[model samples]
Target: MPKKYLFYISQNYSFAILRPLQAEIQRRGGDVKWYLEPNVNASYLATDEEQLTTVEAVQVFNPFAVFVPGNVVPSFIPGIKVTVFHGFDAGKLDWKGKNTHFRVRGCFDLHCSYGKDMTKQFDALAETYKTFKVVDTGWPALDPLFTTDTALNPYISNKDNRPTVLFCSTFSPRFSCAPHIFDAIKKLSESGKWRWLVQFHPKMGADIVNKYKQLESENLTFIETDNVIPLLKSADVMLCDTSSVLLMFLLQRKPVVTFKGNQQGEHLINVSSPEQIESALIDALKQPDELMQHIDDYIKYIHAYTDGNSSARVLDAVDNFTFDSLKTKPLNLLRQLKLRKKLGYWKLS
Candidate 1:
């Protein structure tokens, strides 16, 4: 019989991250069933072939392996719980938040690291728990960024002569650069020399979302979607804060201006405050070629593989866990029950 896998999508943004892996698994003669969060919109099921399953489906299907993008998974669920991770940023400070660059909660049976730095970290954490396999499979979500056709990106436009600027921000009220750089962005948008595209984290506050939505003008466009690979492909320069999206932009070997970011490395124009926005933008747009070396070095550090085959590697890890079942670890019952209740998975029972 063909193998069966379960993909747990907790949010809309997860589609961008998990779809590549799901498609690859199906190509390899495996079946994929999506178990979605209750809040996920029906519109996300864009295909007749794509059916939304539930926690009860997971229980009955007994998939060979379960892939999760978010950190937590129900401990009681059968099959190996595989963590694919969300982003590559290590964060600006020790914020103790959910997407804290890198973290390990003993909920997963296997931990797939995107690069060497993360592999070592997960290895150390696994030693402490003695309950998971740490494998260095590059993040599958980024596969599109490497192999995408630019023409498919809806946000691209050739209507103007101005350089395209993508302004992306995290949703965190404390760490986000949105609130701090609004005035500077407004001035730049009014100049008409640069085209601005604004995209934010899904969790960004309603007031802030509304505030930027109102900023849409001739030179400025507000994009509301989870898929950013297209925007990354289309922009000349990126303006961001401490969000992991900066890493995504950097992967293009393009110039990026960051406001108060936590981690520092090559090719990033780090500004202390919003006042430096104009100068930074000028420098980045004028000499983006000069920053390629730095961007290349950072990309090598975070992701060891750039061959557009990370989806294959991730699925190989899944196959390893499923076929042998020897590498799999049993779930921590107490932790499983606690998370099930905390994340509303218990409601399904």
Candidate 2:
């Protein structure tokens, strides 16, 4: 018999990345299911019986090792579960194990870190975990963006994002933060110089939307929450600070503007002044060949996997790696030993 598995994500947003893995799992004769845990907010880490499975319940799934997003290893299903970081760097998924307020303890396994260099933010997470793997499975979200159609992407649902501008967070102070880059956008909106779409983090529901409402710009519509890919497509140009969402936009290779706060601050795009910001935006608006040259590298990073069929490649890697351990005990001691070492821990002593 094949292994039966229950796949879980903290929110609906992760579906794009997880779905391909899901299809791959099922293709291999493993049973797969999605666990939607409501009330699982960014502000809190307590897993609810309904919102998130209790530690005991996760154990019952008997997953042949689980694939989890980020490093906040939840105590639930502690025996199993690996981290599949859904972003470009390790900082994007910080589960210190000390911050119980943010993680359920053992909620992570191995993670990708978007193929980013592991020496910086990634080193600590690998040191802390007893078992973890870093594969170039690519950002789960990017898998769908490259493999699927624009119609499948939400921003272009209508086949057009007439004036969409996504408020992708910098994730600096916390998991995600609104960068000052958007202040420039608010200015144009207030003046009715341009119509835009400000999509905040799905986890940051209500708070940022309320702030947008306070801004009260009629030309700009504040989208509280929607899958960002579609909004990314709908917009002619994306204004953002240093973020991976810019990678997504490059998949479309659509015009993009880097948000440079001021001369004093740091940004992924080296925004030293309002002048540079205007220069970048103006050039992007004009469709300059100079800016077009960078799009090639952006696409390379966006599609880290060699093929657009990354879902298949990731699944193949997992399938070839998957074993019949489920037929024996819930886990193989050998595998468990390896897993323990992978997480940089002794087997629960």
Candidate 3:
């Protein structure tokens, strides 16, 4: 019998993160199916992709392993739960001043870490939890970034050969640079000195989204898409705030200009004022030696795999996992109840 795998997704972005792994699983003669929560749009599932809509359907499928990009998964489900995280640690803090990225929700059996820094942190967490194991398999989401041809990106339209600047921001009002930098971007786009592409987080405010959409012209284009990889490939430089998407752009060995980033990193050209945006973009496009060196160093620390084989590594880790010897995960009764209620699954099994 072929190995059966389940992909439990909660958001549209999960598709990009898990598709590479799906390809790898199918390549190995495995059957893969997706289970999208109510909050996630079912329309995002491609015609060729398979989906299990209800918890009952998922139980019937009897997958050998379940992969989740989010923090939590239904422990009652019949599978070895594995977590392939959604994004990089952009140093965003929670209400209690805790790093949100490393939080242990007691749901996963294995954490497929991105690189050395993440592996070290997860290793410590595993030692403390004693329920889950850490494996540094890099990130499958970035596999296409290294392997795909950027020339085919549909968004790239620099007919005049002008520098392309991609602007992206977080949705949170507290951390977003969108509101602050809009005027400056408007002026720059009007100047026609550089080509501009604006793509915002899906959860960004409608008012703000409309405001940027109005800036579309010969020099500027506002894009709305589930996948940002193509946009990342097309841009010469990226303009961002505290969003983790900047890390994805930096992995391409490119420079980024961030607006008052929450994380202090030498790898980014962080500007405190809107007035500084243009100069920073110019400097970033130049790609100075020191900035490029810092980017390289940070990439090595976060994700050193540029060979586009992270999906294979993730499968290998899953295959080698000692499921029989694993300890019991935390009960997490309240969380379990919440998940059950959300999925409308009443059975104890």
Q: Which candidate leads the pack in lDDT? A: 3
Report the C-alpha lDDT of model 3 over 1-349, residue by residue, as the tens digit. Answer: 8999999998888998999999999999999999998989988889999999888888999998999989899988889899999899999999999999999999999999997988999999898878999999999999999998867779877466899999999999999999998999999999999999999988999999999999999999999888899999998999999999999999999899999999788999999999999999999999999999999999999999999999999999999998565678889999999999999898988
Q: Which lDDT value does model 1 have at 18? A: 87
- How good is model 2 by TM-score? 0.67
Ranking by TM-score: 3, 1, 2
Residue-level lDDT of model 2, residues 1-349, one tens digit each, is 8775555666545655565666666677776644444433433322321222443354565566566654343333433455554444322333553422123233344444443343233445444543443345555555555555665554443534344455555435443335344466566667664556666555554555576666656567666443565576567777665455665775676665654421111112345544466556545666566566666555554354634555555554454553232222223455545444443345243
Model 3 earns a TM-score of 0.98
lDDT against the true structure, per candidate, is 0.80, 0.51, 0.93
When summed lDDT is taken over every stretch of 10 residues in candidate 3, the lowest stretch is: 151-160
**Candidate 3, superposed: residue stretches over 4 Å from native:** none
Candidate 2's C-alpha runs over 4 A off are 27-29, 35-38, 41-52, 75-80, 90-109, 112-131, 152-154, 157-164, 171-183, 191-193, 203-207, 214-218, 261-269, 273-278, 322-349
* Candidate 1 lDDT by residue in tens digits, 51-153: 5455666788888888988878776667788999877764645545454545556678788888677788878877776777778989899888888888767
- Candidate 1, residue 134: the lDDT equals 78
* Backbone clashes under 3 angstroms, per model: 1, 31, 0
Q: lDDT for model 3, on a 0 to 1 scale?
A: 0.93
Candidate 1: stretches off by over 4 Å? 92-99, 288-290, 322-335, 342-349
Tell me which residue pairs clash in candidate 1. 92-262
